[model samples]
Target: MSYTDDERIRAKRRALYILAQRDHSKKELYDKLIKNYPPDLCEMVVGLMCEHDLINEEKYTEKLYRAYINKGWGKSKIRFELRRKGLPDSLISQQEEEYDTEDFIDEIMHLVDKKYASKLDFSDYKSVQRVTAALARRGFAYDDIKLALSRIKDGDYDEYDE
Candidate 1:
């Protein structure tokens, strides 16, 4: 679809205004602009922004990944959110380059100690299941949650346990 110069300028300004509020993936920018602009115009505007180094999906992904990790979220949840926000698999895969099962295990343990300590009970099967379910909802894998709970139950103390 052909776009007028005026339409292009307006769309570009709108895109910049939207981006100024916060970082957005190119897909996100296009999605937002499509609400008011034509698809072709959105694409052209986004491409221009990309050419100018204004839209950096990598930086956005890195920031979000770290934030989710610090917030005690697991990789599955992070990937879900990134995809939800319009990031493609290629970009999301970068976060997995140094993947380590141990990283999420530590996060699981932190959540158990900090949030569920008062409620968790290894002896009570129902209590254990409840905690496990909650952690799974937080995107933690079943095996990792079980391992973390076991570590605590067996008195395999870490510094935090002391």
Candidate 2:
């Protein structure tokens, strides 16, 4: 079905409005516009948005990667969320490579110190298990969580440097 020029304008305006609030993946923009407009129109608008640099998967991926990392999220969970947001595997992989390996470990340790440092007791099996499960739910691996716990137990992690 052919869309009128006015409808086309409305679709474009709505797309811009959504984008202005925050950056969205190309697929995200398409999904939102497709709800109110025809598939073809939404496709056209999404295509134009891509062509004009209005929505960039790489940029969005990097932004999200940095944000989640700063928030002390693990790589596995970050990758899952990026994929859910419609980011390509290549971009997500590239973003992961762009950061140093130490950064990931540091982030994990930082999370432990900030959130679970006090209640985590290696002597208490239940306490240790609870902290491990919590970190796993946050996308941290078992080995990494164990390492962080050991570091904290050994008094190697300094939580009061702030």
TM-score result, candidate 1: 0.93
lDDT, candidates in the order shown: 0.87, 0.85
lDDT of 1 by residue, 31-131 (tens): 99999988888888999999998999888988888888888887889889999998878878988565577888888888888999999977899999999
What's the CA error at residue 71 for candidate 1, in Å?
Answer: 1.7
Q: What's the distance in Å from true for residue 17, model 2?
A: 1.0
Q: Assess the local accuracy of residue 80 in candidate 2 as a C-alpha lDDT between 0 and 100.
A: 96
In order of appearance, the predictions have TM-scores of 0.93, 0.91
Q: By lDDT, who's the top model here?
A: 1
Candidate 2: 10-residue stretch with minimal lDDT: 153-162
